[model samples]
Target: MGVGGNFWDLLKPYGHKEGFDFLRNKRVAVDLSFWIVQHENAIKTHVRKPHLRLTFFRTINLFSKFGAFPVFVVDGKPSPLKSQARTARYFRSSGIELASLPVPEEGASAERNSLFSTYVQECVELVQLLGMPVLKARGEAEALCAQLNSEGHVDACLTADSDAFLFGAKCIIKCFCPNSKEPFECYNMSDIEAGLGLKRRHLIAISLLVGNDHDMNGVRGIGLDTALHFVKAFSEDDILNRLCEIGKGNASQFQINIKSEDNIEMDGNSPHKKQLHCSFCGHPGSKRDHMKFSCGYCAKKDDDEGCLRKPEDFKCDCFSCGMNRRQKEQKRLENWHTKICQKIAEEPNFPKDEIIDMYLCNDNGYFSANDGPHTVWGKPNIEMLIDFLNFHQHWDPSYIRRMMFPMMSTIFLRDMASTPAESLLFGQYEFDSLERVKMRYGYQFYVVKWKRAGGNIAFKVPSKESGTQDVAVELDETVNLLDDCDVPEIHQDDECSFLLTDENMDLVGAAFPAEVKRFWQEQELKDLKKRKNSASKSQENESPASSSARSIQLNITEFYTSTKVKHQPKQEESSKNNDSGDSNMKRNESSSSNLPKSVRRRLLFD
Candidate 1:
């Protein structure tokens, strides 16, 4: 049998007994539920790392020295059906303002209490060293640990609570030893039964009648003594029959607690009956809509709450509504899309370039894309799309906000085709133009649209090989430049006042010496000169190149569309080729390193 708790301290009294040596090799399975619970709090307090070094990790080190191995099992999230009462208690204890629900503080007192239930890092390290598989039950981690013992995978279940008894583990070792104590006390289920003068079934019934500490609905007014009487006298059939009768008699009242006011036996056979069931499917699951409990099928089908079902006699996948439910989902999605489009339209800061591009081109690249049968990019708003990118370095959120403008509009239409017409349609723009723009804005080319007359179209295309490496570096350079510049304090419309401010224009002109700099500075000064004359609005000056040209550059080596091979001149055995006129002619025919000055400037900056 596995030995746990302060076994070392307890066994100290029974030292060196032959065969009792099995205690050393017992391979004790320690319940890590408390560890996880405590860890969540420790991590918040910044004591988790230290705790790992001292407690769990230290145990591993100590055990290794003695040639003993221990396995630790962590507690998982509370099961929906099993822990509803406990959850309700926690929620009540939190006393959080309803408003805090939307913006819960990171380390709120409630979270700290919950984290206290999470085991620290050392538990993780200890498990890794032991090479034991970590098991997670469908709903509760603790239940799985108890089940492991029940199934005989573990010699015995070790835990701080008595809940494991409900799972029917043969033996449980509670508080075996925390630090050090003699007799290293452990209470077997049989011993508990003997002490209480009740059978195992009676014990389970009492637990159920009283309600589990985690989640249970205690039959009101059914005290332990009254419950004990029924457990001793009634058979399973008798108890179930009475329960059904009582339930039916009160069916019209829409509640089941009246009969529960009279004490009766508790049974473990159907511990789940009192808990919440799927309203549509009648499945005995809790938190079906919370956190990780989402139904993948329902999510994939349509992300609406109505798709989740519960019925009294629920069976099979479809809820009571069946096909009608599906039809409703389709209508819901259409309505949702309309509202989303309207919201985007109202947001002034939304990238106009991206919006215009998506609207003009029949592609959903800025929002979503479908790549053949298996893959699909989910739709997202401009902020969501931009935030999806992984940044290499810390960046100001505002700079990224600005670049998301034109970047959002550029759609990736379709995969490149070798045919001339197709190439001209999708791949006509120099790859450099595309790469430089994306690099500067931290955008992935989402998808391209087919230039159809109507309807949304999109195609996936991989970035071209030649310009791929430069994208990251160029983007980083642009970010660095933006970081150095002083951000304009005024809004986009107050451009004239901002430009005329000597301090502001000094910074702006130094960053970009192009057309934008000249226009803003010249107008700012001119408008300020004559207070008597009406404020003259200068004609809108257009920059020959778009705003993107501020950071764009071209590589000369990539100017050629295709590679042309030239034969290498064979070296002469003698000094003849070195001295020969033909060799000189071949050398002169090769490409030149230096280009015309205007050509060099154009390639570098144009």
Candidate 2:
């Protein structure tokens, strides 16, 4: 399924840390297929229901609790080249003939594949419900996960597939030992390169030679050890040429049995004739035309006899064409060669820059990197997650809150304020000094005056409202002089009592002059009272009007209910009036009819 066992043997074991500790505050990209396959036996049931839902739920929950943000990547459509291996595995596992399997229609849905069963769908749904992202890859999920990690979209990839290394994954967490006290197994790219003495290119080459889903059985007689040796011995360019030569030599060994009716005879006299056989059309000829190797059958004009027109026209009785067996084999070999060439020539097709841009862009919604209170990683959506765990998972809200507070504060403060650590001490007034303080609704707010600019700035001791007490204590410890400041306790309505100082005033070395502090304190109290009185008056004016409207509606409803008198007389009087009006209109029409046509027209005009 991946690189052979010998390749894995070369990988050195990285030292362990507890799974929770190692993954804490990390963004991990998970290969969904690997997870599903790893838990296949435990999750699958006879009734076709996946019992693994709970396992997946608990696994993701554990990651979240440890502060690991996981992005689940599911496999999309399988590569066309992988179909043979998939089909072979299906036949072996299901014990059904490959012919019995439904042929994949053109543009068939990716979900129609056997690998993505209802159980996998259920797992994907569970991940989505947990507010985690599930990215459906364009091709292989492992490749996508590797890309995500390599590009810094995630800190590491969680995949057992060894091929992820070849895909350029910097770090791989092979498996999660959630129940074990020890940390999970992980591999680093640096370690892999050092231990194996192979770069990414070499790893890919080894996989191809050792046999993979794309190239089954690899080169005959070549095993993992031989492949490793070959890769180490040859440069990338040299390895590709060597592989091509080996493929051509192997193809030449197959004897071409020409049919009597085809008039193509094997020339035993010519040494090169045996090697010139057209592996497709069975036409033997010279191996070189104009110093280029040319398959005569493929080069033949359409009008020429025995020239293969379409892929379907290759049907013949020759050894290469019997039931299309050799045709399929030939195609497979060509595909392998093409892929090898591409790997050697081109870079890995990963949208690394695009993914980085997406993460760095400040966007609102799920999967946004900058969605939290600060731009630092893992701070966004934390509150929503804490709430979810507290209510749904029945976790103690206080415990969860306590666990996240310090981590969040450290990252938030590091990002939000770039104030140097030394400057945090009030005793060191090189840049700024604590000018004034006010306590409002259990929060201690202070004003800092920058000495150089004489600019005043306000700051709260505890930034977050929920954990004010702890943050306040931490602030006091950080700035010991805060305890000496005479902070006045003010009511809730007096929150904005701190005033901006004069722009030109210079108090570079003065430590909160008593006279200036007293002046601001008196002015702050007067402003607070004024604001409170105006706020009360606005509320009182709004409340009386609303109350009067409610009373008027109630009175109207009561009057209507009490006055239910009969309306028969009103209906009778209205009917009589209608009859009189109709009679009067008829009399007017009779009077107009008696007049002359011109006179009636003039009267109507008048």
Candidate 3:
């Protein structure tokens, strides 16, 4: 329904580099009506509604994964200018009489119209559920898309409508291929101007002359090349002036003059010879031409045999050409519809926000000991995401985790014990040295490891004193406590690490259990004892003469004990064991071996 008959040929040199991957991390505004219309064939053919929903769902899903945030713009109502076409189509499709057409306000009375409306509603719902915002345009969806692109709300407008160019979209994607193997077909306004040597107004003028949805019958015999020539030569206002001048004068004569100038022959037999030949090829025809009549337009220059031409080339003023064009257009429309439906059905709708909130919260402030619901933080949500991916796509959970987890904000891990350990283990340790501990704001925190919770480290801070000695702490007091305890590096690691480190010894000593506190105290005592013993030895070593004499006396005693033990051991054992004693011992061992193996082994080994 756009500027037909190879309108793209003039702008082919301006075609954009293909591929949708470039759209990653970009925001695009989609013409939802275009999509629905493009998928109309699928909707009509399918028995259930899921086929339609699947189309939208899959398309949005691909966009999301590719990091393209799409804003779907749906048509609100048919424009007044396009009302005739809409009414005709409605009546034609529904098999309803034109006289029986319902008024706009009364809603569609035809079954086909009602079904189409329902499908549109379902599409909107599907997109909404997929988390893409849906906007109802006051006029056409393409117009809205163009506006959004112009306003910089989106990077581009995705539509097949050539009218989108007239609507002032800077960038338009003519076709989207969801598969990575097939690239998208895009067009840039800049490229168009550069390649075609025409501006926006000139393009609009050409559309007006060539015929479009708004103007069904443009100046006949004025094709793309002729339209381009006329537009380029005259200003937009001057072109309109010329059209008006021609309209007031002999329109047929003007068309013939234009056609003759382009070397197109007029019908010689006709009155005034004003009627022109076929625009595709210069052939004058009458109503008598049959379906098999050959077109000189589609014929080869050297070939005189016209009847044997390709079936598609038989474009005479015959019933066959009319039927051929209709069939081709219908087929093209159906193919386009099927492509959009498949794209929508294959893409996924991942719950990005819900998944993020499940894993991480914005305000990660710690709750007091008496506070309800301890945040388990990222673990459960990460697991949930993994499980969801596994169940839905049968993807490896590890791969999903690898791809997803690093994208989450680290602040959510504030309550987790591993947050600190990871920081310290990775040489990012940031705790103040021990001597800084002091009682500030009459509240302190001790870093304690919770054994029951798989040894998770956390900060233990006292709550506000209620009548029963437990109440919510005042905000000011809590602020002061945080300020006094606030160690920059420690906080960066986690609150737990900040409290547990050496800087908060006074709090640790008071708040930790006796065993935990005693363990630190014992280590300190041992260190002190070692230092004192070393000092005592240094003092003793200060008297060199006394140390030397003690060393000599010790050497003499060691020599005497070594000689006596060496001489006594060899003869003493031999004298004590006579032959008879040896025989008696052997007999006793033999008798013991006769006992049960267990008793014998126990007696021998134990």
Please report how far candidate 2 places residue 125 from its true position, in Å: 2.8
Candidate 2 regions exceeding 4 Å error are: 5-7, 12-19, 43-52, 93-115, 178-181, 236-238, 245-606
- Cα error, candidate 2, residue 136 (Å): 1.6
- Leading candidate by TM-score: 2
Per-candidate local distance difference test: 0.36, 0.50, 0.49
What's the lDDT for residue 487 in model 1? 18
Q: Write the per-residue lDDT of candidate 3 for residues 403-514, one digit (tens) a residue.
A: 3321221121231223333232112223232323333223232332211122223323222331211112122221111012121122324433332222123323433335
In terms of lDDT, the poorest run of 10 residues in model 2 is: 476-485
Task: Give per-candidate clash totals.
Answer: 31, 1, 10
Clashing residue pairs in candidate 3 are 38-337, 54-345, 55-344, 55-345, 58-344, 58-347, 59-344, 61-348, 466-470, 466-471
lDDT of 3 at 179: 31
What residue runs in model 3 are displaced by over 4 Å at the alpha carbon?
40-47, 88-112, 178-182, 236-606
Better of 2 and 3 by TM-score: 2
Deviation from native of the Cα of residue 566 in model 1, angstroms: 99
Report the Cα lDDT for candidate 2: 0.50
Against the hidden reference, what TM-scores do the models get? 0.32, 0.41, 0.40
Off by over 4 Å in 1: 1-22, 38-51, 58-69, 75-77, 95-122, 130-132, 177-183, 197-200, 213-217, 236-606
